[model samples]
Target: MVNENREVTEKIINELLHGKICTDASAFSELHRIATWTNPYVDYAYVDDYSKKTIAIIFFDKYNDNEIIKENTVKAISEFDMVVDAYDVHSLNEANFYLQDITRTRLNALPISVIVYDSNGKVSPLNTISISEHKATKRTVKEQRSYWCWWRDGSHFEVATLLELSQKYDDEQGDIYTNFVYPEFFNLMIEGKTRKWDGTPRVKKYSTSSYKSEKQNYKIPMCQLGLWDVETGHITHKGESVLCVIKRYGADSKEFFDYLAKIILIDGKHLDLIKDLEEFQKNNTELIPESSSEFFILFDDYMTQKNSIGTRKPTAQKTGAKKAYVRDEPKLWNKLGIVKLQGKSRYYKSYVGIEFDWDRINEILLADIFGGSNEKI
Candidate 1:
């Protein structure tokens, strides 16, 4: 019976790899059952030919033993040089987003071979699932929506400024932003010492409202990380704690930057990515690129595997992840005294320094922040 099942599984996988859509629900179910028996946590599995590699995407409703699943899946497909991407999605919409991202097709237009298993373990063809019943409201051609990407404008200085500014405001009042915060921040930027522009000191003027841009770039992210109150625009206890760190060790200091890294990793909810990158670096040392642009290509693959869903288009999803990695996280690393930018350009050529000490810094930061607890912050 085991021999027969193994034969059946191989046949199904072969068919999938060759672009055959398995419409027979029973055969797909059997394949799913066998995959589940191999790793009980798998919620969905599908073959992807979107890229150069023949890839298998395994979905989970909750993250279980991710390494075990990847190991077993690799062993099962040992005959082929296939790549396996595993994602843990919390909602049906989130799962649907990944499906659309992988296939570059809407949920209603997906290939039949893509099977979906909901939280209750009910399996259905990918094409049959409806992400939304109501037709999307159409806008005029002139009123089209802009492509979405992860916001990445905030820096440590701006964050510190906002936090310090918040300390002067009453925490209970939510209406302090428009009247006080915006104008005050604008003056602070303009009236401050002349900043260097292209090797010359130049007096700067506010191009747009500082509040509008900073609110999106700084306030929203700070709120998301629990440093600022979303409604009140006041600093939280967490934010205050971070402010103390900033005051003790200046914003540019390594101690403060390490704390920022910890906050961004734990409170910003990116610990999983750090852990995954650690493993990826260990295994794929030869694959790591010297240039930042080239490095982002490799990063995007892992981002896709992790099912980092934000934008509507697959291209946007890739672009957005690359932008965040380059602009936000690595920029922070560059400031942390660990990562040294190589070139004169805003986006540097390499992160050679980060390659060596990333795991060490991550280990120390995680241990310090979580107090050695394995639980997700």
Candidate 2:
């Protein structure tokens, strides 16, 4: 669908660069409500500067690839360093106060304010056509750099990091090698030598637990932890993400599950815990429900308990309780960590999970500790 406002904007920019141009203010004021089929939401505005120059503005759908529009719009205004502008879907119904500062104006209002600056003495449609061709060259001339941002998220650790990330599971340092993140921690496990964090080449060292109960736990590990990619701007798990270095190899479900669960519960509170729970079940298809009634009730109780903690001093302790139960014990059996609310003897919130030895994820090892490969840029 043709964005009439944007179309008018292009026309206006073309004219303003040519010379002084104006529009009928009364004609725009007549429309009641305006929108475009491409992406509904009449969020367009006009901006002006202290120098009395005016500009038309519009928002776009994130996926909207208005190649010509962006190129031409940038080209139309490029010569005028007097006015800086941008188009994005992020701002909606927000007025550009400088133009005439008042949001009462709707987006359907066309032929918006004047273009105040014009560096081009004889810019024409032909030049606007050239904008696309020259844009890449122009951008390269501008300063640029590449920074490797997030590649994985908490989800990645379920497979590797849980082995080493847990401060409480410090006793389980021996088991960290099996951590899901292990494979990717040192250069995607692609082609590099693992190094100690202190610039030293590294290798795994074995451990023997003094506690007999520890012997009953899973075998010790022999790998490293890694990172996952997050959204471009958001810094936390709330945004969309995926496994990065951890997935350089295949995946380990046990580690993946543990990492994912921690992230969901870490925030403590969000829009609705139940909503996240539902999503969890939908994503991890491995979980089997042993006790539905108890699980639901405890989940609600956990929600209440989670909220109650705010009134008290902050600490890892929650209402003086820990959740730990085996499936055959009782329907109302208690478990600890975030899954304390489960009804079954064994309470797992979702099918996906990391096989945490209930003790290892938090262990701190004083053994001749070794680091892995250095992260490359």
Candidate 3:
């Protein structure tokens, strides 16, 4: 037990040096860009024959000046606890830059316990603890591919999957962003235009999954992939979704999409798009449009119609001039899709996905709620 204590503390120090420790849900969503390392407490670790659970940590450069770190870190741990079988917490105030980092890792272990520190330096939040061993689900690597969206309302979320303005977003300020919103992380797309995806010569020599070299085993990148939608949420085909609180109970595809369909981007098309958005908002409305036409928003003009302001779309638009904005017949906005910012759409703004999974990280969160195995997705 004494040796175990030493080992755990050593791991905790590593995590604090590299992982993000955040408290806000929306903030974490945006922290997707700044994260340096992923901890098992939030990323995939172990979960049965299929499905990997995840936990995310947001790192702070100076925790004292930015005291929110304590709250955010605590919130992160609690959220992970609810979804994960178990996790670990440690401070790395003593870490040196030359060494390796290992912050916010979750490990599967018997006799698991939560350790919190007192302002006075006392650690170990639990006075009495219970530790238990977990048997592996014996799932093969391929069976680990499945996972669903982590709703905004869900207990904890995976931040590695979305795009944002560096931080969750500041509704009051126009385009004002937090420090974490933008980081110097190497963006592959932006880099590919100038430099190769990776700077390493060996990496350049090897083809990515899309272009596998007959010489080696490689995986294709999922950066441009779509969001996961199981029974809980719907992943848009183009993959731009404004996450909202999820209904606690699970939902079917029809019922789930119904919720998203209500919140469609109704503003932005040059001419007409509101008519379709208004109808799409209704729960009972059947909107199985022809497959040829993809869904989209017309623009703020749709909201200007006094009757359309807060209510759902008109039951049906009057064919002629009476229809302020017409839901044009058949066309999808593929050229440059729109983005939702401050409850409105910004036309022609593109989006991409960012994922954080640590098959390479050595630690695993022993979170009991999620079972002490590494969960993947």
Find the candidate with the highest lDDT and give its number.
1
- In candidate 3, how many Å is residue 203 off? 17
Candidate 1 lDDT tens digits, 1-377 = 11222233344455543434333322232121111112222322332223212223343323333344444444433322232232322345554555565455332232223344433333443443221222222212222111111236455666677777788775536556555564666666677532221222323467776446654655556666667666667777888888987788776665665677666654453444344455566666677777666766676576555434222345646755445333355554444433433555343434431342455454435544323232221
Alpha carbon lDDT of each predicted model: 0.45, 0.27, 0.24
| lDDT assessment of candidate 3 | 0.24
**Backbone steric clashes in candidate 1, count:** 0
lDDT of 3 at 201: 18
lDDT of 3 by residue, 1-377 (tens): 11232233334333222322212122112111111112211222212111222233232322322234434444444333212111222343322110111123332122122334423333332212221122222323331221211111110111121222212432323322112222211122223311211222122222353232211111011121222221212232333332322232122222223223222211111111322243343421343222211222322242333222222234423333223232221111211122122213322222211111222111111112213222111
TM-score of each: 0.47, 0.18, 0.20
Q: How many clashing residue pairs appear in each of the predictions shown?
A: 0, 44, 48
Q: List the residue pairs that clash in candidate 1.
A: none
Question: Best to worst by lDDT, what's the order?
Answer: 1, 2, 3
Worst 10 residues of 2 by lDDT: 144-153
| Deviating ranges (above 4 Å) for candidate 3 | 1-112, 118-122, 127-136, 139-210, 213-377
Report each candidate's C-alpha RMSD, comma-separated, in the order given: 13.9, 22.1, 23.4
Model 2: per-residue lDDT, tens digit, 1-377? Answer: 11232344444444544443432221121111111111111222222222223232332332243443334334434322112122322222221332233113331122223122122222121111111111121122121110101111122322233333332233443433234233234323223333322323434333343222222121111110111111111111221122432343333443334333333222111112223344445554454344454444444344333221111123313655234211211221121132343334344544332122323212211111123211100
Q: Per TM-score, what order, best first?
A: 1, 3, 2
Over 4 Å off, model 2: 1-12, 20-57, 60-186, 189-377
